[model samples]
Target: MNNHIPILVEMQKLDDVIAEKLVLTESLPKRLSGLKKDVEDADNQVSETKTRLEENRKDQKLKELEIKSNNDQITKYKNQLLAAQSNKEYKALNSEVAHLESQNSLIDDVILQLMEDESSIKAQLEEELKIQANAKAELKANEDSLNLEIKEVEKEIKKFRDQRNNLAKDLPRALVKRYAALIKNRNRKAVVFNNGNKCGGCGYVLRPQVMIELQKGDEIINCENCGRMLVFHE
Candidate 1:
């Protein structure tokens, strides 16, 4: 049995585990950021709704003031009519009062429409506020758990790397260096199995002589195409 082959196999296994943990560690931060974004989007929706509601309410107040001002003008015109010195002046005062009344009627219709809009907006705002509150609570509840999970994954990755280093110490220094370089350059695959005369790493067809050498497993055999160590698994 080739000692380096078995050690390389073990190292490959450790690398596989490290690869999985690295992917998870990388994704955890993105997941946490997604959650944060959800919360932020919900908050923005609530804020926008509140702003619209405030503007609508302010418009409603302005409309009400305008109606009050119209009524005051109508009242002043009626008092002037009572002291009118000519028929023309009296008729003019009456026309002015009628116009003010018609204007007030139009403003009243607008106010009614605004009130309906306000009601709908208030309902929508209430719903958005609830959504925002729930999103905040969910983010707060999961934040610590997500951080802890990422830390645990980091620890596992560190442990696997340390184990790999320890395993490398038992192999020849040159062999370990070759393995490390292959793993770095070959997508983290230093040793690959020969699959039916095919190079498992690069899927290149293997020569009969190369397959024979891999089957003996007496020494490290490199795949001709990928330069990865080829091991025959009985």
Candidate 2:
């Protein structure tokens, strides 16, 4: 049996864990970005709703001013009706007052309609504000949870790295260097035990002589086809 096989296997296990940690770390940014996008979308919707409400308020104010102006005109025509001296003048003044009254009625109707629309818009704006507030709170809570999880993963990564470095010290200098090089090239999995005459990592068939040498396990043996460090266990 190869004396170093156990340590090499330990190293491989650590390497697998490191690979998983690195993948998980890399995926966090994408997840966070997705969350940020959702938050931004909600905020944008709220902003648009606020803008619409402001426009409705301005429209309502303009209609109110128009109604006030029409009321002022109605008062001015009423005074002129009281001051009319002749029948012809009285009739003309009456006609003018009637026209002003018609305009006032139209302005009043427009103001009423605008007031109703303003109330509806205000209600909608209030509902949207509530929704936005809820969404913001939920997003903040989710971000806090994700941050805690990332911290835990970072702690695990540190532990794995320390354990891997400590394990490397127990390996021979040459073997350690070779394993490090393989890990750099192959994403940390340097050695795998073969099943019979087949390489496990790449499933390449091993020669009988190579298989026998692997069983003795005195020295590190690499698969000729895949260049992965090979081990044999009976």
Candidate 2: C-alpha lDDT: 0.82
Candidate 2 accuracy as TM-score:
0.74
RMSD of 2: 3.7
Clashing pairs in 1: none
lDDT of 2 by residue, 1-234 (tens): 567888888888988998898887878756776778777877888788788778877887887787688778778877987897889998987787788778878877877787787788778878777877877776787887777777888899999888988988987898888888888886566898897779887888999999889988888899887688997867
Per residue, candidate 1 scores C-alpha lDDT tens digits across 30-107 of 989988998999989988988988998899899999999999999999999989999999999999999999999999
Clashes of each: 0, 0
Cα lDDT of candidate 1 equals: 0.91
Candidate 1: deviation at residue 20, Å?
A: 0.7
**How much is the lDDT of residue 49 in candidate 2?**
79
Error of 2 at 101 (Å): 5.3
Q: Pick the candidate with the highest TM-score.
A: 1
Q: What is the C-alpha lDDT of each candidate?
A: 0.91, 0.82
Query: Each model's TM-score, in the order given?
Result: 0.94, 0.74
* Shift in Å, residue 71, candidate 1: 0.9
